[model samples]
Target: MKRFVGFVKKEFYHIFRDRRSLFILFGMPIVQVMLFGFAITNEINNVDIAILDHSKDASTKEIIEKISASKYFSVKDYLDNENEIETAFKKGKIKAVLNFEKDFSKKLQTENQATIQILTDATDPNTANTISNYTGAILQNYQELINKDIVTPYQINTQTQLFYNKELKSVFMFVPGVMTIILMLVSAMMTSISITREKELGTMEILLVSPLKPLQVIIGKVVPYIFLSVINAIIIILLSIFIFKMPIAGNYFLLAAETILFIINALSLGILISTVSASQQTAMMISLMGLMLPVILLSGFIFPITSMPLPLQVISNIIPAKWFIIILKGIMLKGVGLAYLWKETLILIGMTLFFIAISVKKYKTRLE
Candidate 1:
């Protein structure tokens, strides 16, 4: 009994001493709880919305004031004409637009009814639907508030126009997200484990001793994986197109180029992981545990980043998957070209270069 108790104490001490174990036991749970608690919400707050009030009448102004005053939405832009709506959505800032037709006040008072069109970017159907519902609820409450003294109550008709996805198909949203997650996990996990395996088996030293330069060795190690990863990307694209009937609105060549860039970004990240990890198990664990949650939650795959708290929203900027997912949605749903997508493309390129530079520096340090 004494010997067994001593062994248990030793095991506990070993666990407490290892920083990685301590992090896994205590730090990870807290982080996961916080992420899940804050990021897993469906409710949207302070969502940016644009206004196009052709009437500019008292009724229109009051309705606009009510919308802007709500905790759910902020009036970001007030457009002069309908031509600006397309440009607004392409910029990816405004989520919904409130268009008050001309004669809103006249029609509401004389005919006892008026129309307000809610144009929502339905690239995310769930969010679009939620916005429509919330806006409708607000209008309903306003109608009730004003009708208490009038003999004939005024009715506000909202015609919701869902751009990009008329049917509100949930599949349209999930396909791009699934593709992003698959590519990130497969490319990063595989390359990290492959390089770490070489190091574990003592073959990396043999390669270093050869005539090949350090950069050449690293490139050679990742080249085969790149080819394989591209093929995997192609397969996923074809599946999204044929099996799911997903739309590809932008140029195929540009889409292919962006996909290749994201895959390289992921592969370079894997190489950086390999530099720090000493074994295949460690590499795999880091790739799976470290990358999975951030990719799924912080990437804005399912949840709206705008709805999240300020800290998580700021943290999401550093996530490569978040940028790639934006690129995918822009091309696939919005039919946007390079002119509109330049910022996100540049960000991925910068991240890829940074990862490669770090990996090369670490590789040289290992040589010393």
Candidate 2:
């Protein structure tokens, strides 16, 4: 028994000497817990949209004010005519447009019915659908408010319709999510293991001692995975088009470019994981145990981020997948180009830069 105990102690000492291994074994669990606990949410907020109020009356103005006040929407612009709606959506800055028919106030009082058109950029079908539903609920509540004082039986009836994804297909929502998962699996997780394999085999020491800079070496390793990820993304797009009958409403080139950006982000994260792990096994464990849940739960892929706890909603912003998914929905489904999606694109780019910077710093520290 003493001999067995001695062997166990020896193994632990060996493991402890490798700081990366210790971090993987002990530190990763905490990261996983925090990510899943604080970042997974199901609610949407501060959605940017346009308003076209043809009526320009007291009732319509009141409804617009109520919508503007809601946490779910931000009225970014007011359109002058129906012709401007398409142009505004094509610009991509707007998610949905609210059009109030002319004489909206008078119609509510005289005809007991008023029409409000909710025009959603349904490239992200789920988000568009949610915005439409929320608008309907808000309108319904407003109906109840005005009808409350009615001495006789009278109610303000509002008609709402969904544009783009009029069918509300659930599959449209998950396509981008699945593509993201495939990319992460092929790019980030694989890149993590590839770099750690060199570390495990001790070849990393030779490269570190060589004249080539550490960042260049890391890039060289990650480039192949980028190609592989792009190929996987192409395959996903093809399947989505041919089998799922998904429409590419925006620029195809933009979709491919954004996908590459997302792949780079995942690759940088993988490289960071490799820098923190001493063995391929450790890297794989970190990639899977530390990241998979966050990618799925916190990315707004499966669950809505807005309905989550306040802290979790704030944390969800940190997940690169969340931004990528939004970009995917925009470019693929909404057909909106860079104008509407630059913010989300910037977020992904920023994350990639941050990960690369951290990895480079860590690599230099190890060299010293």
Candidate 3:
């Protein structure tokens, strides 16, 4: 009994002394809890929406005011004409557009009915459906409030039109996100593990002593993985198109180019990870924990970034996966060319360059 107690006490001392162990036991739990609690949410808050008020009447204005007042949505743009709605959605801020039919108040008074066409960007069908439902509920509640004293209750009929994905298919949303995750994880994980494996097996020293320059060796290590990752990306895209029946409305050449760019970005990140990691286990853990969580949580893959807290929203801008997902959705669902997606593309390019620069610096430091 005394021996066992002393051994346990020594183990406790070891745990307290090791910062990594202490962090794994305490810090990780706190981070995981906070991330799960705050990042994982079904409700949408402050979702940006556009309004095209054809009626521009008293009732229409009041309804718009009510929607604006609600915490769930913010009326970001009051579109001047129907043509501007598409442009707004392509710009990626506007999620839905509330188009009130002409003569809304007059129709409510005389016909005792009005129509509101709720056009939603359904690239993310869950959010689009939620927006439609929430908007409809607001209209329904408004109808009830106005009808309490009247003999005939005025009806507000909502015609929900889901753009990009009229059927509200879940696959449309998941395919892009899944593709982003696969490409990111597979490319990053494989590259990091590959480099780390060379180090672990004591072969990296042999390569370093060879005639090949450090940069050349690093590129040699990465290029095969790049080719393999590209093949994997092609397979995924083809499967998504044929097996899942996902549509590719944009240019295939452009898509291939963007996909290769993202692969390079992810590979550069892997190289950075390999530079700091001493072993395959360390590299694997970093790739999986450090990269996977952020990709899923902060990349706007499963949750809307706008719906996340402001701090998280700002942090998400730094995530390369977020920009790639935006690019993919823009090309696949919105069918927008480089004109509409130039900003995101530039952001990815900048990130890739930054990652490569950092990895090269870190690798040289490690070589020293």
Best by lDDT: 1
Please provide, for model 1 over 1-368, each residue's C-alpha lDDT reduced to its tens digit, 9 standing for 90 to 100: 99999999999999999999999899999999999999998999999999999999999999899988999999999999999998888878899999999999999999999999999999999999999999999999999988999999999999999988999998889998999999999999988987788888999888767888778777887889889999999999999899999999989999999999999999989989998899999998999988999999999889999989999999999999999988888899999989999999999999999998898888888788
Error of 2 at 365 (Å): 2.5
Q: Which stretches of candidate 2 lie over 4 Å from their true place?
A: 1-49, 66-77, 87-94, 148-155, 306-310
When 1 and 3 are scored with lDDT, the better candidate is: 1
How many Å off is the CA of 320 in candidate 1? 1.0
> Judged by lDDT against the true structure, how good is candidate 1?
0.92
- Write the residue-wise lDDT of candidate 2 on 6-28 in tens digits: 99999999999989788878887
Where is model 1 more than 4 Å wrong at Cα? none
Q: Estimate candidate 3's alpha-carbon lDDT, on a 0 to 1 scale.
A: 0.90
In model 2, which range of ten residues has the least summed lDDT? Answer: 152-161
TM-score of every model versus the real structure: 0.97, 0.80, 0.96
Cα deviation at 141, candidate 3, in Å, is 1.7
Residue 151's lDDT within candidate 1 is 96
The model with the greatest TM-score is 1
